[model samples]
Target: MSSIAEQDLADRRARAIQQLLHTPLLHRDTPSFDTIATSEQWLKEWFLRTCGWILIVDYRRGMARLRKVTGWIDSTHPQRSLRTGKSTFTIRKYVTFCLTAAALGEHGRSRISLQDIAVAVSDLSVRAKVSPFTDLDHKDRQALVDVLMLLSALRVVTELDRTGRDYSVDPTGNVLYEIDERRLGQLLVAPLPPARCSTWQQMAADPHPQPSSGAPLDAHRLRQHLMRRLLDQPLCYLSDLPDDDAAAVSDHTEHITQWLSEAGLALEIRADAWMVVNRRAGTARSLRDGSNVSNCALLVLPQLTAQPSGWISATHLATLVDELLDEYPWWARSLRNDRNRADAVATVLRSFDLIRPQSDGWRIMPAAWRWAARVDPACLPPSSSPIPTQPAQDDLFSVEPTHQ
Candidate 1:
């Protein structure tokens, strides 16, 4: 291929990889469908080779799914609501989701009304000895509606009702839906059917299960597991991995780094952790987004890095936030309260694995040093001297890819 054609192909492949990472299930109507569909073959091979993920593309039906598997379950990322501030799914919502899916699978006809689905789900819930869906309860009704909306988003079901009103608004409203049986069948990416597994651990079992104690390690599977964590998680810590896997990472650092680079990601390796940074805008959340929580987290970083022992007591952290609040009067009004602001900052930092809770307090992780702010002489507090210099890097909190 010509240089121009080769560049275009590379760009398309990168974009497709990113799209699947952000949204694993891509429907025909999604804006990136054409790009992903065109690069289907490359994506399949690339994902399988790099992360052991399966990429399924259906051209005629217009859908693509990246069946992702990981050695560990990530509770941080959950199936969230598409509406109402995009809240994470609650226990009720999860139960309702499973019940609804079961009901849909059992329904003989492709067309069903919202009311009928509720009745079917309730029946199933009762038979399964779980909490039955109460149609009269607003919370119960809303949870069911949320599940249906999620299914619609996945293209497993299409709402036929054109009414502008939401089903959540009226529990008795009959919303018609046309189910796509094929898409629904493809929704579950489990290695085996739920009926065959009694526990969730069994359901999510790896096809080529990890070897028992003292057994020889499978180098290829180890690489796949490591790559999967790098691609799917915010950060991969050496301490979190088994000794064998950690050693593998050190032994094959160069190979793994090259693998990430080919996918348009920069591998940022610290002494204790690895972070895959995507230069593409909007690929992931950045600390510089100027949101209240993110801004606070950035401000809190200096305090975290300043600690000599790499640990900060919760009380001390709150005091730091209070001082910052007084210094930066222009901060969001919502953060006026010291405790709330401190909690928000800590939560955001923890989400990025920059700081982790310890029995004593919060331990500033090695990755936290990457975002250490440069102390300005003009803004230095009267009692506090400049923080000790940190190891140099190209940028501060920049998601832009950089060579190590």
Candidate 2:
């Protein structure tokens, strides 16, 4: 081999050695079956959660921890996992995510639940539009539980408590399982840095100030702010962002999209506006009125129009008014007549990159206008805020933002 190739191999070996030695689960061989493999996977998952990523464990990118503790692996020869199974023969993705999130200690208590997992999984399977759902039986549920129990036997996780959910009427209701995270940190203390794309630097090309970790607010708004920041362009979307983060929009959008059809939103590729229809529960008026769904519609709608083609005339476009009215009939009745309402909504839409104007009418941006809108409205220079008349200052802080 070339010297460079040899050196590269040696470097990888050294790093792998460092990873094993530094991580809590050091190389230690032991006898384990399917249950054992499940347990190890749980432990590794927990390690990930403790470090700040919530990943579901079931059928995903096909990662399986085939064996724990391969013995005497060295540069010359790689160690092979002793035990192999024909099928993956392990826990589902949802259970793994719960295990890992629970392993993050108290920080994860709110989100880790059987209902959450089921909803998340069902939603993912549904949104992905890939299931008949009739085939899974009680045996399937038990089999999943058995895998978790196996994880416990392998000393991968400790069960803190268990509670039954009553679905007594028919098939199944709900079940809650609780897990402990005391051991996950053994693997988490010195985790490696995330992949290059997962960094904040990747999102913010502008050197705008970062939010303090302690920033206070509602989770969704925070997520919206982040969505605006990270997803500034056409190709950028939450699916393109991290699934785990304090930002509410990213997390909630990802969470809901898994259950709600990506089709549920009324975003047509042609229109720059986003519309939401009732997936469930609308008042007789709402079915016709479309308001409560409207608030949510407004909240989520701006997200759809990422790339606006041109200027939109509010006078010409009564559709926004009608849609808003349908979503919030009561509020719409009151707000429609407000003098500055159209301009206000238009400005906000512009900030959100939802709308633009063409030669004649309003146009929608197919890609998100989110990134350009990342700056908080409060951060906008005031009317009284002097424009830097000086050419250099004006040039430096120009309204035109580079896509970088």
Candidate 3:
């Protein structure tokens, strides 16, 4: 690209970002540097908690991206291990694409279709660049299906959504298996797929967490309401806040702003005061005016809970995560009882408004861990009293909660 063209693209991106920020209040125009630092730190910690040590690290960015690695034994596994280019940072080569495509399909974190891999790798010879078989153009899908078969045979992965609902047709006239993610960790060597948690179910079971609806309307109640409100959209401004809201936030505005800012929610700086909104709606909110905060807040749940403004703070967050971890021991595989681990967990909990920080400890926010427990009773520790219902009301990643 020419320098002028590159500059134009950069300028366009800058304009787009500025426009995105415009959706925030004037005071919320920019994040305080502390929040930025906290977010970056939290992202890194989140990856490490799940990936262990082999994650891709960016020292400059202080972050890492994880790759799923499957470990299966076969007469072929040994052979491939001995041979050149058996595994890679990516799914590789043309001839090997039969296996490669399946690995990408079933195990890939990114939602790459078989054809997405085939087109990108067709011309290259390296493990990183080889394409799937493309003869007769449409026949490549059998190769992908064959690859999944190989994976199944090798125990690298298994197919889920067995109704065969997620298949994509390969160019070669064959229908390929859409790789299932639930049991993907069964394919890996050391690290495993992070277990998905059901927030609603857990909340439903928690003695500490109150009802999903109807509350004394304390800080916790406020957070629960906020999370529920976000089901419809991103944020709610304080000035325009509902009077009937029993769930008010921290009495102090500055601390509340800092806490939400540290967590995933951000405050838009307006001419008068800052504002807060759900981060997922960050993209949408970025495009609209601050007037949309209420709508967005109302949009996020019962799909996902929103953190009330009352519960905010990096320090308090650390403790809340510790408590949640204590309550849910199954995820203990991912949690270590160390300080950094605590810090990382706190940051994410903070993002979701599950907790707020005090000078020395975390204060559990209005959100409930029982939600996940209620949704997935199997998640409770074996010794604990059995929950009466299935906790998994919906898939973790899908938009099922929206329909709720």
Q: Backbone collision count in every prediction?
A: 0, 29, 75
lDDT of 3 by residue, 36-74 (tens): 233434434432332222333333422222332222111
C-alpha lDDT values of all predictions: 0.76, 0.35, 0.37
TM-score leader? 1
Tens-place lDDT per residue, model 2, 202-242, is 53332222345644445543433332332122122333333
2 or 3, greater by lDDT: 3
Predict model 2's lDDT versus the native. Answer: 0.35
Cα displacement (Å) at residue 52, model 2: 23
- Regarding TM-score, does 2 or 3 come out ahead? 3
- Cα miss at 202, model 1 (Å)? 2.7
Candidate 1 has which clashing residue pairs, if any?
A: none
Candidate 3 wrongly placed segments (more than 4 Å): 1-209, 217-233, 237-247, 250-252, 260-285, 288-404
Off by over 4 Å in 1: 162-169, 193-201, 313-326, 333-344, 373-404
What ordering of candidates by TM-score runs from best to worst? Answer: 1, 3, 2
lDDT of candidate 1 over 174-228, digit per residue (tens): 7899999888877787766688999877888877765777453577777777788
The estimated TM-scores of all candidates read 0.84, 0.22, 0.24
Name the candidate, 1 or 2, with the larger lDDT value: 1
